[model samples]
Target: MESTPKHQQLLHLLLLTTLIYLSSAISIQSSFPQEALPTKSGYLTINSTSGSSIFYTFYEAQNPRTPIYDTPIVIWLQGGPGCSSMLGNFYELGPFRVSFSLRHNVEHLTLVRNSGSWNRIFGVLFIDNPIGTGFSIAGSPDEVPRNQHDVAKHLFIAVREFIGLEKSFENRPIYATGESYAGKYVPAFGYYTLKKNARLAKSRRLNLAGVGIGNGLTDPEIQVGTHALNAYYSGLINGKQKMELEKLQEEAIRLTRNGNWSEATSARLRVLGTLSNMTGLATLYDFRRLKPYEDDLVGKFLSSVEIKRALKAKESISFEVCSDLVGNALNDDVMKSVRYMVEFLVKNTKVLLYQGQCDLRDGVVSAEVWMKKMKWEGIGKFLEAERNVWSVNDELAGYVQKWENLTHVVVMNAGHLVPTDQAVNSQAMIEDWVLEKGLFATGQVTQKPSHIGTCSIG
Candidate 1:
């Protein structure tokens, strides 16, 4: 049939528009040394309203039971109060791990496939948070966030931009997660995002489903007090040293009460330092590791010209595992408790706190100690909930205790870094929780209530 000239012109325009839209939907996935997940790395220019740039590496869920859109969105942040998310990207949970090697006259690192990468079930986004960390940079020192609240606000903008960049991610269930210092970052950001979503019209809001924290340092006052207990029980300190450690923690709490934030963190670290020295333990982060923490491998790998050009990493800034500049800027917020923010989410949504059982710092002891003092509606139920063995591949991997809207997981035989030590188990745990689609699947529902698991798990 013969069509009118104007009709034909309109048809051409429509086709052109559709082509442009499809192109924008999927970003370019670069080839890597270890070809595993369909991954893309880039920077989200904080949003014009809040002019900061954050670097991110996004990997779509590999081998998902449902479509990628149905799979949960997991944003991972590594903590040092200033650590690069790239540290998590290469060393912990991401698909490609840096293969470290030291040779005569030179040392080099390479990428290797991580079979237990979390990307197997959840779409993962690794972000360099709070600005001025890793490849993310600020034009001046004034641009960096000075407090936890500011850090959350900046991250909120960055995530919004990230979702906008890919239209397919607009409606997915979003989860904010981090380890270590992120204990403060996750709750603050989750609370802020949830509140903002409530205020905005439905069409203008971003969906924030829940939050997960691994070995977090959220409550300065309470967490500091656990050092003495963890040290004594782990056999890292004698009774005499523990007594002195308890005194130091008391001093830290007093400083925290008096609003001396920086001094509080300092006091707490000194207690751990003494324990570390006397016991000859290498690092408080991981009692299992014989050697000290080596972030130099990550720094060298990222700083390599070959890697930068291959990934099209455009950031002109140098990469560091932990940024001293960021740490110094945020010292004043070290003692601030994120309990209020976490409590807000606990009332409305779900919160997951997964800890390494043997970690001397930011482990089960600290989490349980501070959690008891929280004002969340779930506190009573969480406390009363029984621990149950969680199995992966038909073998017990961890213990889970949940109540109301909060779930706590303890990965046994694992130190500070759960993913690095018990990767497959941790990945299975995450997938089951997200797909099970329960706010808090307490063990009592699956089993009867008890103080601990009936069987030795993990």
Candidate 2:
């Protein structure tokens, strides 16, 4: 049959469009490598109502005594309210640590196997929590959480989805763990999990076994109050200077008491900034170091084309170590106390609170003050418990105190990031605490479920 010139032109245009589409697809496919990741990684929609999702990377235990499915899972949430959990993953306890090298004046990044990864005997799940941080995507600006309540809620949903996705994860003991700002998060999540579990059927409950916090800022009122004393005692300030800092601390406390939360957060920052100005030290995180701990390497590595492709991260969203947007949004919630949550968690679950000896912010003194203030039935017993010397391979690692379900440890020669400062020791601490070894062998820890069962999604 004879065809018109218009029909012939339409056919040619269709063919050209199909070829271009195929070419674009091929180009996109070629950009990413064909290799598989060593661990399971992906995003789970946590809030369908708000269109939010969370990104996670799961590493199975490398040397578990039992089957992989039966091994305990540690869900690590890095604090900053805005900081990415990837920092905890790469800089601290992930199976691989990011290392850098210079050649011909150009720096190269590489991942090296870490001997002290926390996943040695227990599965580790690193989550970039709360939307709009790390690779986690928020549907809109409104989707970003403004309070610990929303943060815990999002995390709860994400974990429920994760467990539902994998049949074997149902029965595994889960520990909510994190450091720094996550001090609030860990307890909030634990408390929320317990609250939710109370109403849910037995088969649908989250198997939350315990909670662990390291150098965390759980109670800002008590924690912030310790700054002046800690600084003065550490020789960063004199008596007169201490008095001045105390004035600033008092103002922060007043604002916190008045419920001017944002103002309190600002006041807290001012207190820290003033201390930094007076000390002229490298970083309050670790005063011994002459320079600040740099995380530019981590930002560089995670944002690279190759790493993003490997982790299934969206290329459109840039990776940041911390998000100021998130920080600003939660300013009002910062100075508020989560002490009640901690008190509740300590009663219901195994609570391990640890501190780095040298950390001025949210460190030993601050934790001690709050612990003394806790109205828990075991507080007296905890304070009276004998402080036992903890060692790793015959070397002094730290001092530990245990009473009932609570354990507190003062890690020697460590600072804000204990895992990063004392890798081997921190790893050993987690392994022992989770497995109920050494000082944690008091036999009062929560028992793991003996039978494995699938969780039904409500």
Candidate 3:
């Protein structure tokens, strides 16, 4: 019953939601039909004061008539704190959702036709964060901060540099979005940006709009508590251990009261392991990848000979290439990012939390509990909407909860990654919420429905 960040919990249903879009987009991008995406791929570096350089890849929307500055820019972050945004770019949302197909152009597709990609209206920037995941490398492992504030400071410096180099992006409304471990990363970064803005009001360089997180790892206390509780409810653990877990939770709470998180987490982890039935590695019983992927679909659409021909002809993107990485570094980075996010939340910044329904690591039960704890308040009132699909146990499982300038939501039929799990549905909800500010202004779901399909308890 270890709970994930509220954002991560709600995205468990995304696989089902995005299946249709993925099928169609794959067909078109593979040359089964003509497909187009809005993006001009490039890379940039942000040099940190600690002498570490953070690398990021930009995907600018490419429309013959539209200028780059005209498109809203979204900086995408993949969770794991150590995971690569490239995972989101290729496997999840970006312009072209990449599959493990050894195929050519078919491997990726445009965000618009994909129905789940943020590309149609957004200029996407995929960052390999914390200077370890993907291509980003740190000068020293020790340079990475254990506390969240330093992490935010370094990341802010990187983002600020990117903005300085790309002046056009300055004018465009900028938003940050991510999933998994990002629950903390997004909030921390957003807070840092707001702090920087306050300091540089005279310069007026930053044009940040908001922050978004999907299937995030939010507060460790609540999330971990949910993780243990859910496991018991889900029948992953039993009898004496369950009672022991409850007692441990009580102890943890008491420790937190006494400002002893180390003891609290230590006790919590021991109980969590029994509750989750961990097999050495930390993972939830539900929402783990249920099946392996089938064969690569690349050859079915495009021939290797054709790809070779295109390459010989000197084409821009004749072949598809997956991201390359070494080893162990990614895992290390994820751990570091997690610590940083926890520190970031104390700042005054806007945060948007989202997730799919099918995700177990981060799930709806946890989200409900999380909202209650956040002491949230909306800047504007919530709007009632038609055809809301968020529900569980005969209660509207979703809510448009807010705090200051932040908005947190749970999407239907999504999993660990909402954009990838339920691309179209998730995208529709996020786009409206973020770009149009619909969560604050229009088409917002106010009351939870009594049921979704048949999963309601009542």
In terms of lDDT, which candidate is strongest?
A: 2
Q: List the pairs of residues colliding in candidate 1.
A: none
lDDT (CA) per prediction: 0.79, 0.86, 0.55
Query: lDDT tens digits, residues 167-278, model 1?
Result: 7788888888889999999998998898888888986677888889999988878888888878787677889988988898899899999998888878877877877786
* lDDT for each residue of candidate 3 in 264-286, tens digit (9 for 90 to 100): 64665565565555423234423
Q: After superposition, how far is residue 141 of candidate 1 from its true place, in Å?
A: 0.6
Q: Give TM per candidate.
A: 0.87, 0.88, 0.66
Model 1 TM-score, all chains together: 0.87
Give one digit per residue, the lDDT tens place, for model 2 in 45-127. Answer: 97687768999988888889888678999999989988999999988888877787665445667777787889988989999
lDDT of 3 at 85: 67
Off by over 4 Å in 2: 1-38, 443-458
Please give the RMSD to the true structure for each candidate, in Å: 17.1, 13.3, 13.5
TM-score of predicted model 2?
0.88
Best by TM-score: 2
Per-residue error (Å), model 1, residue 241: 0.7
